[model samples]
Target chain A: MSAAPRSASRADPSPVPVIELRGAAFGYGEHAVVTDVTLPVHRGEIVAVLGPNGSGKSTLMKGILGLNEHLAGTVRLFGEPADELRDRARVGYVPQRHTLSSSIRSTAEEIVATGRLPRLGWLGRPKATDRQVVARALELVGLSDRAATEVATLSGGQQRRVLIARALAGQPDVLVMDEPTAGVDVASQHVLADVLARLVARGVTMLIVTHELGALERLLTRIVVVDGGRVTFDGPPRRFAARRRARDHAHDTHRHDSELAAGDTAAVVPHGPADRSGQAHA
Target chain B: MLEILTTDFMQRALIAALLVGLVAPMVGIFLVQRRLSLIGDGMGHVALAGVAIGLVTGLEPVLTALAGAVLAAVAIELLRARGRTNADVALGVIFYGGIAAGVVIISKAPEGTPANLVSYLFGSILTTRTSDVWVFLVLALVIMGTLWVLWPRLFAVANDEEYARAVGLPVLPLNIVLAVLTATTVVVAMRVVGLLLISALMIVPNAAGQLLARSFTSGLRWAVAIGLVSAVGGVFVSYPLDTPSGGTIVVLAVLIYIVTAVSMAVVGRLRQRRHEVAESHEHEHGPECGHEAIPHGDHVDYLHDGHRHAAHQGHYDEHGADEYGALSRDDGPTGQDEEVST
Candidate 1:
């Protein structure tokens, strides 16, 4: 879910690192989901996490939220262990999939206002300011006009945006999204990306778990690659591409040798500088 | 109707109905969201078993039934929390075990105990006691208050538990609280609606509410409204017809649900046809509606990710021509992450 914990480096510093994962290892019973990984996200950074299906990317995301008690390692938010991190008020999350109650019958604005729960204190109602924030979130997600629309009648994309708006209503310091672009269309993807980019520009630290990195690369500050529950690469987007190339080459060579034994030329290709660097790194 | 409210027993029944109205549907929202509609059935049966046990022991039947219901609720919660299998499957197993256990417990009791058990099963709303009314009020207040405080957290966790936790909401306790509240409501409402009819009170209003309401809160409010109306209205109709109040209430609720369902279906069909007509017109012309149909948001761009590389290289070859990839771009934000056609 996170990268190796780094102490506040003087090279770059903000008020504080919003999230830190140190040697984090997460798993379901008897299955290690994510292992021996650390990730640090500070304000104003857009990080994309990439991994194959079953590669434990979602588990790492969950681990940071303390949803799955990772078997080994620690997760910290705002300098406290995740479990003790009470600044939930500063964290917002949009899920990969949402299973809403069938009985749910709220409007989009009302749904967005719910994001203020953590910030509203016990027994607190939404204040005038809270309503303004909700409106802002709706506007950010381009749902203000549909604020009064029935949530159930919304298209899937609108619902997803509503979820994002709900998260944004929290005015979180860190917005964590699990595959925020999973089931939307290309234009909506741009809208969502632009919105998220704008959020990043506003200094909201974002940790996004997504396989759809082509378009997302334009918005990210860094990229993290995970495979078999471990951090294989954590740096810029190019580093991820380089890592992907290495893994692919190793896999391709295995296929090549098998194909050669069968005298198949179709699988063979000349190596290039990019391939060599990836191979060297591997 | 006004005269009925003047009678002490009638007042008790009204109070009980009002209390059950709020509690049942409030908890029903959670059950419906989880798709465990039969949980009410399972818990209702368990409470009936408790009532049978109480009748044999000559204890206050309602109290004993409540205690049994609370224990059953805890068991259900524990099994569900383990998360090894589907919650519905776990509920089925627990409820069946409960029924069997109740049968054995009831059989061991003295003769004539079955009559008391029958009342628990069928309910005797007209006979609701003053003490029962007070208990129902207290329980309803507690449940409603808990919902008021936990509404947002509950909504968040219900949408996605893992996501809620990541955002730092206490999800586990809230779930347990919901289950406990359901247990209490099951016991409290049993006397007014009976075990057999209690779930009707829960599901009917929610079903109707779901048809017309716009949001979760609106659905709840509508469900509560329907329930109160049916409860009071049932009493009115039952008195003139000389019928059992529980049966009357259940029947009336079903009637209301049917009316709401039919109207919603008609309205929904009309809306869909209109939308399709508008869409076809746009296709023939160009963006006449002016509101461009937004494809689902959150569409992933598959080309840039390693998945595309895998697809091109024949890695995970089985996924080549996989519909998931096609769906991915379809789901991406419009015009952003389209895959280059091979």
Candidate 2:
């Protein structure tokens, strides 16, 4: 396993990455959707995966969640190989909001309680502590009032919170969410942001996949940009935005040369006339 | 009706009906909730082929039919898992194929075979033997025991299969177990309600229970209650009215379903109106309440209860078609044609 240095410390040798992927390729069937990805997520960091539509951002999240087939390379969770990490309760996953079939007539509390399935012994009923944890999860997501409400009766935003609360009820060390703000109203996004900020303050490791930053931009510790099934940029959010602005400026100045440089590393690096002269001297 | 119970055959028939009534709906509730209600009918068709095979081979028809239904259930599950065809399409193909095979096999048999086949097709509850009653009792006990032990895991799988899988539950085996249980229930039910009317027993009472009950366990109890009432009541009514027992039972079940569905809708509407009035009153007291209420308006106006209007609309359309097919097969053109041919 390649031990990547944490961004917070340059020389620290003991801080293990909570999640590590080395040249990982994930997909379904024979096709690899996300390939050659190397990333490490440490504790107490909120990493946002930003990408265009159909750019394999969701696939990358699924790879981390072990929802998809890992065709090649290694994925480590909590310092162990992903496949060997059998204690799934340590990692929480909040999937993208999809309409649950109406036949499943469970309340928000009941759905949240299912998160404790990994913790409970087979055939064991929910204990008082489990119920309290469920209640606390609901409270964390601002859904305490809707605890007894049927999930189908709740609005989309409320349903999303219920899903998040379900993951929280497991008391996981790492929380991964896919498009948590997509299709959510602005007010609900702000509420999610507030809840996430609290989770960050509590030292929960978060990996979020989203197309747009929206309300979550302020909370992002790092931004990883994926394009064409590969990670194109990995750095702080401000540097990403600055690099993007510089690239756009270069595109406006020299459209033909920018087109020619599309697949090159220089397309990503911020380049202007001054940088070109400095590069020539070097 | 009470005097009819004095006869030996009537006593056996009553026992059979009661056993089926209590147990069939217990399995049926899961099938209906999973939207696999048609599987009962499909298995019934498969059992018909088994009965025919038994008659030609000089074996016990009930035992043969049970074997056939179970094999068909396993086949259906395997095929569905393979995703070769959609569930309904696969069931339809197997169902019609089974019936067609039975017809061919029965047609090749002696003249007396068709008469016996019709009895199995439409059910002859009054002709049930003591041994049949014993078989029904054993089957009911087995079904109930297995379900009791596996209820929580089965419920989890039925409720959300993918989520259950993610939680490391044995979904595939639970599904197969459920299918096997359903097949057993169908075979047991065939002796009382007949192949044509078996699905009505499995679907109507359970769907009605879902409409009336607020929770999963309560819904199951309601279904069993409804099934028992319809079964016992239909037998009593059939004795007095001189009607076919299976047809009467299905009709009673369908009637109960309609009444419960209408009443639940009425109750839901009333509660919705009351809640709206309270919300509007709050809006009048404080303009800020209006802003708080707008999102809820769309939710209640469309969803009302947890039941999604669109999903229910689709379900009703499909259910209506199935009910129509079941009723027609029970006493309509198919039944008349069989009588004429025989």
Candidate 3:
């Protein structure tokens, strides 16, 4: 039976969150990767989880994917425990670009067909309609022509797009991508941005982990900042920007004070070295 | 060829080869994709021990072998998962233990049963009974049918486990299916190729298949083709040359792999050279000619291109924050916006 429009409305409208994690903590063995984190992801929103390497962004994503053991707190996806949401035909995941080893010689379309695998019968051959869906997914990612191309031959960015196509093939309620634009060229980045923009327009819920602030800044509705395994900030992009500006200004003042304390000798000493190097070069 | 086909044992061996060729390679697709080719070897060794135990105990060898292999496979999985040990390590432990137990069980008897030993270790296709052939055929059919149903799930798991799980595929059951199919293949193969050479049967076909084909499905077809050829071909070779059927089949499979590997290498090189020539021609036309556009289509093109342009490029920038000074930070509005449609 089709879910009623009224039911969708009553469940959670716009600002109402679909995923809520409260004081979440997770770790590998003894070392904690995420701790005391609280964040909410809403439907039809692109929330970028930003942090440095090993800063718990991936850990957070893993928690949402229900891969990691939650040491503390709760993660609810679509108002259900992340693990308990078995009808995750609603969820699409494109893992980190390198998660798949390219030594495997599958075609782009074949890889995309994997997205429909969970929905297939026990002997999971793709039916005629499933093949059509795979084609549609490849076309959506602008990879229709490369459907027969081996994944090992695709450029990094195209592979990323192929991975997205694989996720999109499922026609999920939520799409989670980790660092899609990483190691890709600017043109590929632009193409991927265009694709994400199109998906966003179509109301696909997206959680993208990216470092391309300029590109993601234009796409994301909310910025969830994590530091030391905690949600340091979860708000609008503008608010995040404002907070950073304030923090930077304070940091700049602090640096300036330290520079002033070091006195005028530093600038003169560096200038002499630069002038001598320039003259010697000339 | 007609005379060979006329004999019941030859026909049985040929049919057995066809079935083993199909099932082994089908399952090998997943095993090869997962870089667990040696698991096939480990399971085969375990199967040998099972056959030995069956001979010593006087039980039906095929059934006992299947059960032992399934147990060993599950044991291997459990040990590896629980201990976080490398699969090879777990396999090593089980492989040796299984054989030692089998040897101890076999040595308990004073009078040696060389017929049983020959059948289990080296394989005697001439001794294969019609009843056993029927049993092999049935088991192979059932395993293949089950594998056919679980293809997508198995492929997903082989490609990436967490991604499959995230999309709600029952990864655990699918893993069990893979192990069980492997066990079934070992059992079917035991009647012709014997236990010691079963891994070769599973792996060589796939190795040969991957070299000759492009897609995983194509690889499967090619594996079966090569396997069937080697099986029937090996039987023919053995009959004329007075050699062991199992050894002959394995050798033929290896030879096929070698030839395929050499040919694939040559073709790959030629293709690379052609692409280079094309790339150079495109480059001669200059940047405006869209020489830059082609690199984005290849997987490793970024590593070759990005070093000259972007500093700290493609690294995950957390929360679109302060690390990337060149990019503007713009986190727009918060929460559900009507910008996204249902």
Better model by lDDT, 1 or 2?
2
Question: Which order, best to worst by lDDT?
Answer: 2, 3, 1
User: lDDT by residue for model 3 over B1-342, one digit each (tens)?
Assistant: 479888888888778777776677777778888777767767777887776777777777677788899998777766655547476666788988876776666666336554366566666677677877888989988988887777767777888777887787877777777887887888888867877787888788888887777677787889888888888788778877888788888999999999999998999898656532111110111122121222332321211111111111222111122233323423322221222211
Cα-lDDT of candidate 2:
0.74
Clashes of each: 40, 0, 18
Residue B247's lDDT in candidate 2: 87
The TM-score values for the models, in the order shown, are 0.77, 0.77, 0.81
- Error (Å) of candidate 3 at residue B89 is 3.2
Candidate 2 chain A minimal-lDDT segment of 10 residues? A6-15
**lDDT digits (tens) for residues B299-338 of candidate 1:** 1112322122111110111112334444665554333223
Q: Candidate 3: where is the Cα deviation over 4 Å?
A: A1-16, A29-31, A101-103, A121-125, A212-214, A247-282, B86-88, B109-118, B271-342
Local error of candidate 1 at A1, Å?
A: 18
Q: DockQ of all candidates, in order?
A: 0.25, 0.08, 0.25
Model 3 chain B: ten consecutive residues of lowest lDDT: B277-286
Superposed by TM-score, candidate 2 places the C-alpha of residue B174 at a distance from the truth, in angstroms, of 1.7
The stretch of ten residues in a row with the least summed lDDT in candidate 2 chain B is B278-287
Every candidate's fraction of true contacts kept comes to: 0.52, 0.06, 0.44
